[model samples]
Target: MALITLTSDIGQQDFLVSAVKGQLLQINPSFNIIDVTHQLSPFNYPQSAYVSRNAIKNFPDFTFHIVMVNLFERKPQQLLLAFHKNQYILCADNGLLTMILEEKPEMVIGLKLDSNAIKNTLYCAQIFGKTIKDISEGKSLLTIGEPDVPIIEKNHLRALLGDNWMEGQIIFIDNFENVIVNITRDDFEQQRRGRSFRIVFKRDEVIDKISESYADVSEGEKLALFNSAGYLEIAINKGNAAGLFGLQGYLEQTQNAYLQNRLFYQTVKVFFE
Candidate 1:
């Protein structure tokens, strides 16, 4: 049986998700549908990419990973079907494909309107459902539509290098409220060069050393660690660090042109001695 994984900004509360699955079953009843997450923050590309990147690799090869977040970014007329590392990924052309994959996919094909089994559809479920049905049935990607089309590009904020300091930003806050920083462990070690450093964020909150787990600190104490994704994470032992520290995930400001200059929601600086 073919496995299909789904990740979407659409909350699990409504019947819309089920309706899409029902359509898939109507076309291919043998498809093994699994969900990565349906609680994604709406249109938050960084968060979507973060979760998608971390989760998709665990599944076996040949899984059709469907990402349904921010489907209508300025009303994209086409959807993306990409083959990368022996697996298939589908999503909107919302500049997130570049951010999520880091590199160009091995092959990419755009879904065509003619391939859509349902016409004049407004919701993503209707359009994507039909295209995915065609895909599951051995339809050639060449027959799908245009190939190697220009993908929208977007880059994440990187840790800024300084003489005795590295500036980073909060990339994501997990369900555990652990604040994931943009600084990877390799980046920190390279910049540290064997010097002592302090991670300073919000006012008066500081973590001096990296811990392996929450138990490394006492209950209710602040600790910093590198998460599974290899990014620096700050958390309070058995507590909600984001709420206590007033730190937030990266929020892209797309409405106001002037606000685009300032990108990140919260920033953390590591000062070394």
Candidate 2:
């Protein structure tokens, strides 16, 4: 029983997800299909990479993790199949593989599309489904397709520093409306260097210290903590922090500059004092 997982930006409102799943089942009825998520925001690769990276690690090794977000970033050229960290990942070659993995994979192959397959608008479903099927059927990874082609690179958001200040962008906003920043605990501490710091976001919301948990603050108060994923997160004790503070995620090539000005998405700033 081969396990396959799916994450996509295609909202659940349509039948595309079902059609894609059908393709998988048609190829192999014994496959165990798992839906990681289908509600990813459209073309938001950062969110896809963030969510998939955190969740996929928990799945059993050798499971196939397929990311179907932003498939049309360019044209539907080809699907990328890579074995990374003991698991297999199938996604578009449209720069997402670079965003999802920190380093190049031990194995990567491009599953080229046959002429008949490219005519369908949902070509991703066709190509990726077949690739997963072949692998599950004991197909040698090397025989799957060509290897070592140039994969597009995405510039991930990094915490910027200015002397005593570190400016970081929000990378994700969860269902609880907690804001996840690009700054990691290691990044924050390295920049802190023993100085006391104040994390400020929005207009005047300030958090002086990192908390162990959201419960560290009184209800309705804001708190900052290194989340289980090791990224700094801003959350209200029992409120919607993102909605209340009007903060959202921004990353490379995502939108306009992520800064404190009104023209762009707001960034979290830590001022060491």
Candidate 3:
């Protein structure tokens, strides 16, 4: 049985995920369906990308990955079936695939499915399922879909560095309220360079001092540390940092302005040195 993994924003409380699984099983009863995660934050591209990138390589070779987050956006009509490093990924033509592929794909075919014919997640069942089944049965990728357009390029998030400082935006915030910045451990170490530095968040809120581990600080105190994934994180030991500091991840000035007009809190800013 071929292993097909799913990663999506659809929560398990609803029938959306189960419905997709049912459809896939109907197509090939012997196919093994795995759920990498269904609790991904809604429309959170960076979080989804991080989880997908970390999870994909652990699965067996030839495993088919189906990404369904933000798939219905009216950006452009393009479907991506790509093979990289012996793994297959089926997703929309949006920049999601571009962020994950470490190297260029061997082939990228644009899939055109009869959108009107497939209802709901059945699009995946009919289109992606058929493709996976064919590949499992020893068919060429060229037989599935026609080439439509070359992959679109996207600008990556910027990382700015100075002699004694590095600036980066928060890329993800987990359920624990830990903030993961785009800056890596190497960036932090390079910027510190044997000098004392502090991490601040949300308009001069002294979120943390440098700490090697959570236990380095007293309970309820915030700390800046390198997480297991080698990313810099702002977290409160055994407490909710977001709630304590009234902070949310990745706020936009436009969104804050709308909120401020309604007597809500103003913008948030982060600084590190």
Per-candidate TM-scores read 0.88, 0.92, 0.81
Deviation in Å, model 1, residue 96 alpha carbon: 0.9
Candidate 3 wrong stretches, greater than 4 Å: 102-106, 115-119, 190-195, 207-212, 251-273
Model 2 quality (TM-score): 0.92
Residue-wise C-alpha lDDT for candidate 1, range 173-254, written one tens digit per residue: 8888889887889999999999999988875777899999999999999999998888899999999988888888766655
Which of the two candidates, 1 or 2, achieves a greater TM-score against the reference? 2
Error of 3 at 23 (Å): 1.3
Candidate 3 lDDT over residue span 15-80, tens digit each: 778888877888798989898888877655656666787689888998999988767765446577
Task: Tell me the lDDT of model 3 at 175.
Answer: 82
TM-score winner between candidates 1 and 3: 1
How much is the lDDT of residue 262 in candidate 1? 43
Who wins the lDDT comparison? 2
**TM-score preference between candidates 2 and 3, better one:** 2
Residue 51's lDDT in candidate 2: 86
lDDT per residue as tens, model 2, 29-86: 8879899899988877777778888878889989999888888778666678989888
Candidate 3 yields a Cα-based lDDT of 0.70
Q: Which stretches of candidate 1 lie over 4 Å from their true place?
A: 114-123, 126-137, 254-265
Name the candidate that leads on TM-score.
2
Tally clashes: model 2. 0
Q: Count the backbone clashes (under 3 Å) in each candidate.
A: 0, 0, 0
Whole-model Cα lDDT of every candidate shown, in order = 0.80, 0.82, 0.70
